[model samples]
Each structure stands twice: as C-alpha cells, then as structure tokens.
Target: MANVIVAGASRGIGLELARQHVEAGDRVFALVRDPDNAGELPGLASSSGGKLTVHAADVTSDSSVADAAKSVDADGIDYVYIVAGIVGKMEPMLEPGDWDTFDEAIEIMLKGPLRVLRAFLPKLSEGSKVIAFSSQLAASTWPYGGFYPYVAAKNGLNRMFRSVAIDLKDRGIVVGTIHPGYVQTDMGGPDADITPQESASEIRKLAEWWPLDKTGDFYKWNGEPHAW
Candidate 1:
C-alpha cells in the first residue's frame, strides 16, 4: 500500500478522501488544522485498523507546513494530495469588495499548495505522485462575476503544478492537477450532482492509472482531460 499524505483532511472532500484511502489499506497521514476538532477524522482513522495518522498544520502558514513536513520526513511518502482551499464570500470583481478576502483565497488556494509541495518534496520517493486540486472554474469563465478571485487562484494553481511536473520529471515525481466536479461537499453545497465518494473514487482511479505522458495534464473527477 502507498504511504499517502493528504492535506486539509479535516472535512468535506478532504475528509472523505482520507477515509477512502485508509479503507483501501493505504497508510494515510491526514494533515488538519486541528486534530481535536476533527469530528470524523479520528473515528475514521481508528476504524481503519491503525492505517491513519493525523497531523496538525495550517497550509496557509509557512512555519506550520515546515513543521508538518519535518514530522513526516521519515515516512517515505509515495503520494501527496494537496486539497486545501477556501471559498470566500462570493462578490463581483469590481464592486466594493473585501480585498483581504481575495488575498486570503489566493494565499490558501495558490501559495498553500506550492508551500506544501516544496516542504514535502524531500520526503517523496522517486516515483511519488503530487496531486494538486484545481477547479472547473479555472478552465471555463464563470458568467457570474462573484467568484473571479477564486477562479484566478485555481488557474494559477494549475500553472504552478504544470511547472512542478516539468521540473520534477527527471526525478520520476509525477505532478498533476485534478478538478473535482460539483460534489456535494461543504464547498460544493447540497444541490451538487455528485457525491464525495464518487469524486474520490474517480480521483483514486486517475491517480492509480495516471498516464506518464500526461503528467502535467488537468483532469476531471471522471478521468476526462480538462481544458486549461
């Protein structure tokens, strides 16, 4: 089984992904901002027959990511799933908006994943996989202007992962981006069409059967190539 590290595993799709990985017998290192407040994670891990370990770290903080990386340095991880993100209050780009909110979204969605990748690069084995989460918004322009900043952040993330894929190619570290569909998670909301389980299953399949030639490609949960 693969030694996998999943960031933002406290709730939503992140939590479900951790559960699925542990169920599959892979050793999961679940990174969350608060372990004690992780309602479903501890139970999920405990029930996994000791296949999960929880670590506390804020992806938006450099020191926190660094410390978490140090703690997991000896694990020899095979996959790092960067799934931390936020949906700031929806607002148009031109309106009197909270610039701070936009900045926070960018920090969490773009910089956070890059920081995680840099921190965990050393612990990754030669054939390790780095899967960064992007969004469908990154490809298609939203008709509503409210989520402009969020979409921009995801677009930036896609580019960053693509660059990392090229840089790490010689090291045999495959880096790719995944755009989970509108799953019914906290972020995706209840009216969404797909479930977290469905999204995770599709993502797991893509991770396992990732084409070497498409290392930097963007993919949807259903394994179709995303335009971007």
Candidate 2:
C-alpha cells in the first residue's frame, strides 16, 4: 500500500481523508495542531491495524512541522496532502481590517503549505503527488467579491503550488491544488453544497489518478479543471 501523509488532519475533510487512507490499508501519517485534541484521529489510528500514526504539528511553526515530519517512519511518501486552513473573517477590505486573522490566513493557507512541503521533501519519492486545498474564490475568473483573507490566501497557495509543480516536474513529483467543493462541515457550515465524505471521496480519486501532464493545474473536487 502507498504511504500517505495528510497534514492538518484534526477534523473535517482532513480527518475524512485520513480515515479513507486508513481504511484502504495505506500507511497514513495524520498531522494535527494538537494530537491531544485531534478528535477522532486517535481512535481511528487505534483501530487502523497499524496503518495510521498521529502526530502533533502546527503548520505555523517550522520546528513543529520538522519534528512531525521526522516522526513519519517510512522509506518514501507516495502522497502528501496539505489541508489545513482557517475561514478567518468573511469581510471586505475596510480602513482597518482584522489584521490578526488576515495574517493568520496567510500563514496557514499560503506559507503553511510551503513549510510542510519543505519538511517532508526528504520523504517524498519520485512520482509522489502533493495536493493542497484551494478555494474557487482564488480563481481570477470568479467575479464575486468578499472574504478578502480567505481569497487572498487561497490565491497565494495556488500560485505557490503551481511554481512547485514546475520545479519538481522533471522528478515526476506531481503537485496541484484542489477546491474541495463547498463541503458541509464546521468551516463550510450547514448550507454548503456537499458533505465532507463526498468531497473527500472525489478528492481521493483525483489524488490517485491526477497525472503529471496535468500537474500545477487547480481542480474541483469533482475532478473538473478549475479556472485560474
């Protein structure tokens, strides 16, 4: 079975991805900000028949990510999914914005993916696939406006991964971004379009089959090419 790492797998879609990989009998390293408070990840690992390991990792902290990456006792990682994010303030630009949350969004969604990638590079083998979460709002074609922090962070994340895909193309390391739909979860809220299970299921398929030729492209959870 393939070795998979699901970063920010404390709950929601991240937790669902961890569960899916564990059930598939793949070795899964599930990372969270607090292992002690990682909700179902601990129990899932306990019952995963040695297929899952939980580690405490704060994407905002370099040392924490490095330490967590060191805990993955594997010869190579086949997949690395960076799924940590914060909704932050759903507001338009004001004279004085919520700078703390805005800063947090950039750190977690933009810089965070890069940090996780750097720490896990040693474990990633050729042909390994890395997918990070991006939002439809990040697309330039999307005309709607609002949620400045979330939109900006996702935009930055998409470009960063795109550059990475270009950098790692010769090595056959596929890198791309996915918009996990408007999934119904704590972050997506109740009025979202789909459930977490559905979103994760489709995303799993993409992670498995998304090609090197299509690397650097952003896609929807349903496997459709998303607008840049």
Candidate 3:
C-alpha cells in the first residue's frame, strides 16, 4: 500500500481523502491546523485500524509543515495532496479594493501549498504524485468577479504545480492540480451539486491510475481534463 499524506485533513474533502486512504489500508498522515480541536481527525486516527496518523500542521506556517514532514518515514511518500484553501468574502471589490482579504486568500490557496511542497518534496519518491486543489473559476475563460482573490489564487496554484511537474518530470514525480467539483461542504455551500464523499472517492481513484503522461494538467473529480 502507498504512503499518502493529506495536508489540511481536518475537515471537508481533505478529511474524506484521509478516511478513504486509511480505509483502503494505505498509511495516511493527516495534517491539520489544530490537533487538539480538530473535529473528528483525532478519533478517526484512533480507530483507523492502525493505518492513520495525525500530524499538527498549518500549511500557512513553514515550521509546522517541516515538523509534519519530519514525522513521515524515510522510505518516501507515494502521494501528497494539498487541499487547504478559502473563498474569502464574496463581496464585490471597492474603488481601492480590499488588499487584506485578497492577500489572505492568496496566502492560503497559493503559498500554503507551496510551503507544504517545499517541506515534503524531499520525502517524495520518484513515482510519487503531488496533487493540489484548484477550482474551475481559475480558468481564464470563466468570466466572473467578486471572488477575484480565490480565482486568482487557484490559477496561481495551477501554474505552480504545472511548473513543478516539469521540473520533477525526469525524476518520475507527477505533480498536478484538480478541481474537486462544486462539492457540498461549508465552502461549497448548500446548493453545491456533489457531495464530499463523491469528490474524494473520484480523487482517490484518479490518483491511483494517474499516468505520468498527464503529469502537469488539471482534472475534474470525474477524471475529465479541465481547461486552464
């Protein structure tokens, strides 16, 4: 079984990813911001049939990420999925704009994954897969507004992973981004079309069969290619 690290595994899609991996008998290291206050991650780890370990990590913090990475075994990880992000306020921008809100979104959605990658890249084996969460809003063709920061940040994440895929290609490491669909989570809201379980399951399946040929592309939860 593969050694999988699910960063931002405290709740929502990330939690489901960790659950699925552990249930499938893979060794799963779940990284969350607060180990003490995390909703169910602690309980899940206790009863994960000995396949799960919970690590306290906030992707926004480099030291926390490094500590979490140090907890992983030296055999090298088979998969690393970064799923932390925020949509920020849905309000339209003012004349001068809300730079603070925009910066927060960019930090979490873009820089957070980059920090985790920097800390864990050394633990990734040649055939390893690194997947980061992006959104369809990141598409340049998608004419939208109000969520500018979120969209721009996800787009940046996509480009970063794409470049990483190229840089790590010769070593057999596959780096890619995925749009988990309009999943029904707190972030996705009540009107979202799909459930977190469905999205997580599809993601797991896709990662299992993800070919080296499609290393740098973005994909929908159903395994369909998504245009950048």
Candidate 4:
C-alpha cells in the first residue's frame, strides 16, 4: 500500500479524503489542528486496521507542520494532499473592514501548503505526488468577480506550487493543483454542486496516474485540464 498524508483531515473534503485513503488500504497520516477535537477522523482511524494515524498540526504555523511531519516516522510518503483551507468572506469589504480576513486567507491558503510540503520534503520518495485544491476563481479566466482575498490567495497557491513543481522536477516529484468543483462541504456550503466523496474519489483517481510531464498543470475534479 502507498503511504499518504492528508493535511486538514478534521472535516470536510480533507476528512473525506482521509477516509477514502484508509478504505483503499493505503497508509494515512491525518493531520489536524486539534487531535483531541478532530471530529470523525479518530473514528475513521480506529476502523482503518492500523493504517491511519492522527497527528496535531496547525498548518499556519511552521513548528506545528514540522512536528507533524516528524511524527510520521515513515520511510517515505507516496502522496501528500494539502487540503486545509478557510473561505474568505464572499462579498466585498470596504477599507473600514478589518484586514484579518485577507491576512488569514493568505496565510492559510498561500503559505500553509508550502510549509507542509517543505517540512515533509525529506519524507517524500522520488516519485511522490503533491496535490492541493485551488478554487476556479483563482484563474484569470474566471469571469465572476468578488471574493478578492480568497481569489488572490488561491492564485498565489497555483503559481507557488507551479514553481515548486519546476524546482522538484529533477528529483522526480510531481506537484499539481485542482479545482475540486463546488464540493458540498462546510466551506463549500450545502448547495454546492458535488459531494465531497465524489470530488475526493475523482481527485484520487486523477492523482494516482498524473504524469511527471504534467507536473505543474491544473485540473478539474473530472480530470479535465484547467486553464491558467
């Protein structure tokens, strides 16, 4: 079985991803901000036949990310899925509004994934694949406006990991970003287009065979290429 790391596995898409990985008989390292209060992840782990582990990790912090990776104690990781994220406010905010939303968005969306990847670098084998979820709004081609902070952060995420893919190419690491479709999750809200299970399943399938040639590319939940 392949070794997998699912950061942000407390709930939503991350939790679903962890569950699916365990069901697939792959080794899973489920990282969350609070292990004691990690919702259903512990229950899922208990049923994983010892293939799933739960670790405390605050992706916004470097020390926490490092500690979580160190706790893995694995020879190498085959797949790294960075799924932790927060939704910035949907509507426009004026200058009077607090900048915390924007700050939080950039920190968790832009930097969190990179920090996790950096800390877990030593644990990743030659053919390891790194994947992260990006919003379609991040693309310049997206027409609908609003949600500036989230869009900016995700835009940065796409570009940052693309650069990472280039730098890690010689080492045989593949990095990719995907728009998970409007997944039905707490963040995506109840009216989203697809269930978390649907999104996660398709993502796993695509990621499993995603080639080194398309290392820096973006894709949709159905495996279609996403325009930059």
Candidate 5:
C-alpha cells in the first residue's frame, strides 16, 4: 500500500478520492480546512481501520499548510493530490469590481496549491506522484467575461505544475495536472455531466497507469490528454 496525501478532502471529489484510497488499502492523510466542520470524512476514516488521518489546514495560509505537512509521519508520501479550489457565482469578472471576489478566487484556486506543494515537497519520496486539478477553462476560451479569475487561476496552476514536473523529473517524482470534467459537486452544480465517485475512480485509474515519462501532461477524467 502507498502513502497518500489529499488536500481539500472535506467534500466533493477530494472526499471521494480519500474514500477510494482507503478502500484500496493505502494510508491516506486527508487535509481539510476544518476538522470540526468535516461532516462525513471523520467517520469514514475511522471506519477504515486507522488507515486514514485528517489534518486541519487552510491552503491559503502558510502556517496551516506547514503544520498539516508535519502531520504526515511516513517515510515519504507516495502520492499527493491537490484537489482544493473554489468557483464563484457565474457573473462577469468585471461585475465584482476587482477586489475581494477576485482576490479570494486567486488565493484559493492558484496560490493555495502552490503553497501546499512548496510546503510538502520535502515530504514526498522519489517515484512519488503529484496530481493537481486543472480545469477545462484553462484550455478553452470562454466568451463570457465572468469567471475570468477562475479561468486564469487554473491556467496558472497548470503552468506551475508543468514547471514542477520538469524540475522534479530526475528525482523520480511525477508531477501532472488533471481536469475532472463537469462533475456533480457543489462547485460543479447539479447539471454537471458526471458524479464525484466517477471522477474519483477515473483519477485512481490514471494514477495507477500514469507513465513517468508523461509527468507534465494534462489529462481529462476519461483518460484523454488535454491541450494546454
């Protein structure tokens, strides 16, 4: 069994990823913003026979990420999944007046994962896999002006992870990005094409079949490569 760390495990795809990892006999370290607020994860972890541990962390906070990183005591993490992000109400990007709304979106969607990767890199072993979430918006241009910040942030994440993969390749750490499609999560809404469980399962399959040489490639949940 491998040692895995999943960020944003409180709900949606992250939660399902954690559940599937535990079921696969992997030791899972689930990081969430609030332990007290984690609804079903705590119980799920407990039922997994001590295979899972939840750590409280706000990805936007450096100290919180550092503390959460220290909680994983294994020799090194085998996989690190960055699944935390936010989607604001669909509106024109300029409608928000470019202050708190844009700032929040950038922090949670872009800077947050960068902070987590920086803090946790040292804890990952050689041959480890780092999978981060990107979005379809990163590839396709949207005619709507709204969600500009979200689109830009995910594009930034994809670029950052690509660079990370290049830098870490010789060390045996495979860094890559994935788009989970339009899943029926809180963020994805009810009209989304897929379910969280289906998305998580596809991710697991990708993880298992991931080629070391394809470290920097971006992928879809259905196992197809995505355009940058």
Candidate 6:
C-alpha cells in the first residue's frame, strides 16, 4: 500500500479522495485546517484501523505547513495531492472593490501548493507523484474572461507546476495538474456538473494509470488530456 498525503482533506474532493484512498487500503495522511473542526475526518481516522491520520495545516501559512510537514514520515510518501484551493465570485475587471476576494483566491489557489511543495517535496521519492488540484478555467484552450483572480491564480499554478515537473524529472518524480471537473462542492455550488465523489473517483483511476511519460501535462478528471 502507498503512503499518501491529501492536503485540504477536511471536505469536498479532498475528503472524498482521502476516504477512497483509505478504502483502497492506502495509508493516508489527511491535512485539514483544523482537525477538531473537520466534520468527518476525525471519525474516518478513528475507524480506519490506523490507515488514516488527520493533521492540522493551513496551506497559506509557512509556519503551519512546516509544522505539518514534521508529522509526516520521511520513509517516502508515494503521492502528494495538493487539493486546497478557493474560487472568488465573478467580478468585472473594471470593478475595483473585489481586492480581498481576489487576494484570498491567489493565496489559496496559487501560493498554497507552492507552500506544500516547499515543505513536502522531500517526503516524495523517485516514481512518486505530485498532483495539483487545478482547473480547466486555467486552460488557454477555453478562454474565460471573468473571475479575474481565480483564473489568473490557477493559470499561474499550472505554469509553476509545469516548470517544477521539469526540475523534478531527473529524480524520476512525476508531476501534473488536474481539473477535477465542476465538482458539486461549496466552491462548485449546487448546480455544478458532478459530485465531489465522482470527480475524486475519476482522479483515483487517473492516478493509478498515470504514466511517467506524461509528467508536466494537464488533464481532466476523466483522464482526458487538457490543454495548457
């Protein structure tokens, strides 16, 4: 069984990913902002027969990430899933009042994974995978104008990880970004395309078949290649 890290595993896709991985017999280190506040993660851990462990981590904070990193075993984590992210409300670029929302999006969606990488990269070994929970909105294939900050941040994240993949290739680590569909979570809203579980399920299948040759590529949840 693989040792996996699921950042933002308290809820939604992150939570589902942790659950599914645990059910699949993997040892999971699930990171949430507050383990006490995590609705079902503690319960999952308690019943997981030692397969799952919850750790408190705020991806936007360096100190918090560093502290969380200490809890993970250095015995080689097989997968690091960076699933913590946020989306801001649609706002026109001409509007000058959405700075806070935009800032929050950038902090969580862009810098959050970078923080995770800085702390957890050493935990990964050769042939390990680093999967970022990115979005199709970042893709140039389908240009979207609104959501000034969210789109920009996701695009920035995609580019950053694209370069990181190259830097880590010599180590035989495979890195890629994935758009987890328009998941039916708080961020995706009620009328979104698919449930969090559905997206997580497809992602699991993709991860199982993920080729090292496809490192640095972007993909949809269903294993479809997505344009950068």
Order the candidates by TM-score, highest first — what do you get? 2, 4, 3, 6, 5, 1
Candidate 6 per-residue C-alpha lDDT over 1-228 given as tens digits, one digit per residue, 9 for 90 to 100: 999999999889999999999999999999888888998889999999999999889988999998999998658888889999877877567755647888888889889998988898878778899899988889887665787788889999999998999998988888999999998898889999999889999999888788788898999999999987
lDDT of 5 by residue, 169-203 (tens): 88888888999989999888999999999999999
Error of 3 at 191 (Å): 2.6
| RMSD versus native structure for model 3 | 1.2
Q: Per-prediction TM-score, please? A: 0.94, 0.97, 0.96, 0.97, 0.95, 0.95
Q: Is candidate 3 or candidate 4 better by TM-score?
A: 4
Which numbered prediction scores highest in lDDT against the true structure?
A: 2
lDDT of 6 at 30: 94
RMSD of each candidate relative to the true structure: 1.5, 1.0, 1.2, 1.0, 1.5, 1.4
Kindly list the per-residue Cα lDDT of model 2 for residues 1-228, writing each as its tens digit: 999999989899999999998888899999999999989889999999889999989999999999999988998999999999988877577776448988999999999999999999888767899999998989998898788899999999999899999999988899999999998989889899999899999999999999999999999999999988
Model 3 bad stretches (over 4 Å): none
Worst 10 residues of 3 by lDDT: 89-98
Q: For residues 1-228, what per-residue lDDT tens digits would candidate 3 score against the true structure? A: 989999989889999999989888899999888899878889999998878888888887889889989987647889899998888877677568549988998888899998988899888867899999999999876777778788879999999889989998898988999999999998988889999899999999999888888899999989999987
CA error at residue 196 for candidate 2, angstroms: 1.0
Residue pairs in candidate 6 whose N, alpha carbon or C atoms collide under 3 angstroms: none
Q: Predictions ranked by lDDT, top down?
A: 2, 4, 6, 3, 5, 1
Clash count of each predicted structure: 0, 0, 0, 0, 0, 0
Q: After superposition, how far is residue 102 of candidate 2 from its true place, in Å?
A: 1.4
RMSD in Å for model 4:
1.0
lDDT of 3: 0.89
Worst 10 residues of 6 by lDDT: 89-98
